[model samples]
Target: MFVKNGNCNFFSQKLTFNTLVVPSQPIIAPVGSDVTLPCQLDPVKDLRDMMVGWVRHDLTPGYIHIRNNHLDFLIDQNSLYLGRTSVSESRLQQGDMSLSLTRVRVSDGGKYSYFKCP
Candidate 1:
């Protein structure tokens, strides 16, 4: 069997279906400036209440961010993001996983990973 989503795309033969996701392009900003990373998901099934995770690659195991509803959950083990990280979505319906980073620093220049689920 096949399934169709909001974009009217057809999936021909998969035993299980995972969420449709899109990667946000990397952003460049000057020191002390603000930066926003944009990611997206399509046909989110039922995202009325889902979980979103954002992470950054590092020397260590990396950082794991959990955002649910209107709350932000940054893994306590990672001290780099202690209190300088935040995520927001103006409209989940429109597939917005834009993460806002304030006071951008030279150390903050790196590729970040993001994931969303319903």
Candidate 2:
């Protein structure tokens, strides 16, 4: 499947009938600028109430952010990401679990992962 994200076309796959698709290439952003990491469900599933999480698996408190209960949960978020990560509820309703990282820094360099509880 193909989904148009921003100015690029991203290829999507429906693995096991449900999957989250993201860009194949890395998103390059200048230091201190905000950037949106594109992510969306291939089958267009609504995730408003889903327990969606973004994390840096290598970190101690891996969690960067989480969304559920109709709000953002930050109690366990990593200190490096506090006040820097967010997800759009409106987009989540449409299955776009993209993470918005604000004020990028050198420490933020690395691969992040995503998961949904259920």
The best candidate by lDDT is 2
What is the C-alpha local distance difference test score of candidate 2? 0.90
Residue 67's lDDT within candidate 2 is 94
What is residue 96's positional error in candidate 2, in angstroms?
0.3
- Candidate 2's error at 11, in angstroms? 34
Each model's lDDT: 0.63, 0.90
RMSD of 1: 8.1
Off by over 4 Å in 1: 1-25, 43-48, 59-61, 75-77
TM-score of each: 0.64, 0.83
lDDT of 2 by residue, 13-104 (tens): 86557878999998889889999988999889778888998999888899999998579999999999989999999998898999999999
List residue ranges in candidate 2 displaced over 4 A: 1-16
Best TM-score among the predictions, by candidate number? 2
Kindly list the per-residue Cα lDDT of model 1 for residues 1-118, writing each as its tens digit: 6677887978686454645454445567898887667655555443326777677767255664567776666654256556666655455546566567778778777777777665
The deviation in Å at residue 81 for candidate 2 is 1.0
